[model samples]
Target: MTSTIARPAPDATRRQDSAKPRRETRLRALDGLRLVAALMVAAYHYGGRGGAVTEAWGSSPKVQFPTLHAFFSYGCLGVQIFFVISGFVICMSGWGRPLRSFFASRASRLLPAYWAAVLLVTAVFALPVVAYEAVSPSDALVNLTMLQQPLGVDRVLGVCWTLWAEIRFYALFALCVVLPGANRRRVILFCALWMLAAAIAQGVDEPLLDLVLMPQYAPFFVGGIGLYLVHRDRRDAYAWGIVGVSWLIGQHYVVRELWRAPSPDAFSNRTSLGIVLVVTLGFVAVAAIALGWLNRLNWRWLTVAGALTYPFYLVHEHLGWVVIHALHRGLGLASAETFVLTVVSMLLLAWLLHRCVEKPLTPRLRAALSRTR
Candidate 1:
């Protein structure tokens, strides 16, 4: 009798690769960056609560912190970082694929988990809390389609507002990818035109126009697309150089000066631009690191943390008020204690969501899609 050799199924290998931990990917640096962004968002919300405490009890003997308000202000930058990463990843993944397939794949991956989150939030907020609003069915339906951004509907789920931007970028980029002669030069030119339009709309004080056009954040996404092009062409040096330049722009211009401005209006005009530039640079740096131009940092914990980022982002912002209310009632905790507990809870909840929701669903979805194809 002859011994039989065993072979793995074709779909098994694909599933295994897709489901592998973040550590196995060459793109662990990107995941690390995602984790940082997620944490920054959580910090931002916690910081906001601190600001509220300072505002409510400014003269109270127990409220003696000067840095509390300042801490919450920078949390908004996390969204910019997220926009950059979304641009880069979507561009890279959709490159060379048919537009239909690209849209379908993205829809399949994003919509299921997102709709579930929306339902969960809607159900929990059926009765309004201070920060949480009860949404109408029509509003929720519009949000479910991810078209609320252009419609000027403030997000039903707070964190999902960013996802509206993300979905728009995917759609716009998909159109570009499908267009005739939509090569590098054309894509760049198109992005430049879009950026100019956005800037002009913002300058005119048309917040609705600006929101609809999403002008302020287009460059970071375009920059990500540019990075993808460079990577695809194997222009490693140029990619890293872009990364370095973006870092310098962000550090020297945005974070240092714009972030310090006292007026929100001035900061929006001057510093927000700088933040956008720096975030774009962040995308470049991530790309360079992924391509091995830069040595990887051995941050395994960060890698694991990054895996929980999407879920963290989903839960952290909306649940923040709930957490703060609970802490105020139960612990009678100071702002600092409240902040720490909120962050810890966000991380722990994110870890659970990753294990319980994302991990299980992603594989099954991918398998089902493969079989259907």
Candidate 2:
């Protein structure tokens, strides 16, 4: 006997909506943002206090070019932008992958190149020509583990301190992903609360808990997560508008003016707030421009720059230092000439590193690791 089967209720059918096909599109604006941020970081390293051309080059005075220095000093904000981007991208990419595979992919992408750079730097310092102090064993190990930032050791590769922070953020993000029911909204809310607590804690001279727990700087990463949600929901206009306005305002008022004053500590508090706001907004803007109606504006040069950024960042500062030393001894170039030479050399070296190292290793390593997995 044939029995009549009842159809499922509409509400029951609606509950299965979670199986809907999710959108997956590359945002070019993110590439542009990455390019800009990396350049800014290069500029800061090229133009700031540690960047001053040393006395080893005969009588040439240090190049303290006012405008360039001011712009480069703002490069620290670029690191913050990176933090946000990392949070958003990693969360999205690693969302449902097995924990082992997720970490393996991350390690494959970051470690090989990083280890190569570290070894090269180690050799550089070991050479008598470089005339730098030797790194201790503990420092080397810490740097290798990407834990030197928290330990407060002098950064192994000057700029590598940020990488440690990036790794820490990645680890924390992975932890969040493994938790039960950790949706986009929950991540955003957690990050928001963390940011507020961090802001409050920043003012305290000696806080009860150390910086890691509250991690006042975490909000920027949170902002990136927030950007992911906004983008996921397709609210492109509102996100870009806010980001554009906030960045322009912060760049003009705080970074360009107040923080540029003579005193080293001038506007420290204001600068902090401005950086957080600007980075948060900048991520939104980049995401909006990438995903919004403005996709046509995504330029190829920005993509190239973004692609090479990791190695460029690693090598640029050292290249500047090497140039200043050589020019001082060989040509006795003035600060202006030295500045010009340094800039030119940095670009050339960045391009070379990309071609010879990063580009080749990235895909090859990914493929090799995928096979192992």
Best by TM-score: 2
lDDT of 2 by residue, 35-65 (tens): 7777777666655444233443333231445
Off by over 4 Å in 2: 1-23, 50-63, 151-154, 178-182, 196-209, 235-284, 290-293, 333-337, 363-373
TM-score of 1: 0.71
lDDT of 1 by residue, 14-95 (tens): 4532331222244667788888877777765555333443332233212333454444456567777777677667755754
lDDT of each: 0.61, 0.59
Worst 10 residues of 1 by lDDT: 53-62
Cα TM-score of candidate 2: 0.74
User: What's the TM-score of each model vs. the native?
Assistant: 0.71, 0.74
